[model samples]
Target: MNILTELAQIGNRLDPKGAISFPIYHSSTFAHPGFGESTGFDYSRTNNPTRQVLEDAIARLEEGTKGFAFSSGMGAITTILTLFSHGDHIIVTEDLYGGTYRILEEVFNRFGLQVSFADTSNLEAIEKEILPHTKAIFTETPTNPMMKIADLHGIARLCQKHGLLDIVDNTFLTPYLQKPLLCGADIVVHSGTKYLGGHNDIISGLVVVKGEKLATRFGRLQNSLGATLGPQDSWLMIRGLKTLALRMKAQEENALQIAQWLLNHPKVTEVYYPGLKNHPSHATQLNQAKGFGAMLSFRVKDSSLIPRILKSLEIISYAESLGGVESLITYPATQTHADIPLEVRARLGIDDCLLRLSVGIEAAEDLIRDLESALR
Candidate 1:
């Protein structure tokens, strides 16, 4: 069956009645049959029927051994980081999501977890940064705001050779477009708040593991930390995921059109979309994923045009979050990557003139016209 059909059919087998939609279990704790006999769920933190269905669905979609859902993307990331010891180190993509960068620099660093930023796109740069304590390599391909792609297979091979864990954040291009685990990653993480959730209605995170041992370890941490997704939110994510295939297809098509239009515009200085042949990572992306995702970043000819563009937009919203049904334009320097120090942002090419667009499932021409009007 097609992935679209598989997603829409999730939880149907478990539905007690003939109801098409999966029912949400609102109970926090399940009643035991008798003393010392539990119903497979003792507490909400440990497990919930509704949440389990969503988790299993994601695991199946990502082709991983198991899946774990969290209250938010940062919660999932933080819990995963707990797998390492205090002195352990990790090598990460230089142009990562700002939230991930902030947690590593502000929270994890204070707890003695060390991290090294490297341009993972360059295999040699990753090799040079490995320390004796380096335990894992974390990367976000088609990285946030900048849309820089990392070679997943190459990174996976590097991890295997060095006995390092290969962790990938698949938020920007969800499993529909790219399955990182199949490309040899040990684990794949998602900000379900983005593409997976499809709508801006709920905030959730997911972690899928490639083996039973890693699944067990993460399961323990997920319960202990208690950042698990609530039953209602889990149901919401499941509902959102049901239409992922349709949304992603339409969004990517719209993005490609907008990207091509931006390239020819007088006010646009540069367009960064992996679908473009001129993109530095185009070949690598083509090798690893089914499609270049809907996220694109472009720089305007002048910084002064940004404020006017943001104000002039009618259909597209000037927003912080992305991957929703409605298109969003983000100013990375002030909104997304602001937490990064000015020096680091400059080094990563996240300049004041750059704008990031998260294309929606809108008519391609309408989105292009919106951009044209804003640019004018």
Candidate 2:
């Protein structure tokens, strides 16, 4: 059976298997069978059946052996970074999500860890930057607001050659669109607060590992940090994911339509969308992703025009976060990327005029009309 059909069946089974949604296993401690015995779940801090079910569902979607849900996106990211110790080094995409960039620069750097930010798009740059101390290569394709695509397969090959780990932030595309593990990545991570949750209500993160070794390490760190997702939030995320395929398809369609429309607008200087034929990663995206994705960004002719346009819009709320059932918009330079230093922002090309849109499952014509009015 096809994926949608399979998903429907799974939903049906879960609904009748005692409940439509996974119940919050509210007890903090699980009863042990006897002395030196276990119920496979001794405490909530370590594990819970509801969290396990959600993790299993995510793991199946990502096509990985195991999955872990975290308290938030940064929680997941921090845990992954904890895998590397002091004196170890990592190569990261220069254009990372500002929060991740901040954590690595401020917190991790103080702990004796070393890092280098490089433009991984150019394989030569990556080759020149690798050193003996490098322990991992961290990357994000369709990175943040700039939408710069990373070569996952190429980087994965390089990671293998250097005996380094490969980690990918798969939040923007979600498992419904891209599975980095299939493209040779060692691990995949997500801000379940975004697409996986679909609605704007909850916040969570997920990490999926391809092997038992990494899984073991990740599990230990999860317990150590106490960043595991609560049962109630995990259940909500699972419910949101039930319609993942449908939501992604509608959002993808709307995004491409809006992107194509913006490309012809006189006031728009550039549109960063992998769906566009002119996008640098169009070919690679087609090879690796099931769809072009729901996120896109464009730069207006004047930075000041952003406020005017935002105020003019009837729909598409000006928001900090993305990947919701309703359309959302943000000026990354001021909002999401504000924490990054001016020099880094300029180098990453996250200009003030750039507006990132998370296209929702809305009518395409209605969305275009809103944009047209805003631009005018």
Best by lDDT: 1
Count of clashes in candidate 1: 0
**How well is each residue in 184-223 modelled by candidate 2, as lDDT tens digits?**
9988999999999999999999999999888888889899
Whole-model lDDT for model 2 versus the true structure?
0.88
- Steric collisions counted per model: 0, 0
Q: Over the stretch 163-254, how does candidate 1's per-residue lDDT look in tens digits?
A: 99999999999989899999999999999999999899999999999999999998999999999999999999989999999999999999
Off by over 4 Å in 2: 9-17
- Clash list (residue pairs), candidate 2: none
> How does model 1 score by TM-score?
0.99
Best by TM-score: 1
The TM-scores, one per candidate, come to 0.99, 0.97
Q: After superposing candidate 1 on the true structure, give the runs of residues whose Cα lies further than 4 Å from its correct spot.
A: none
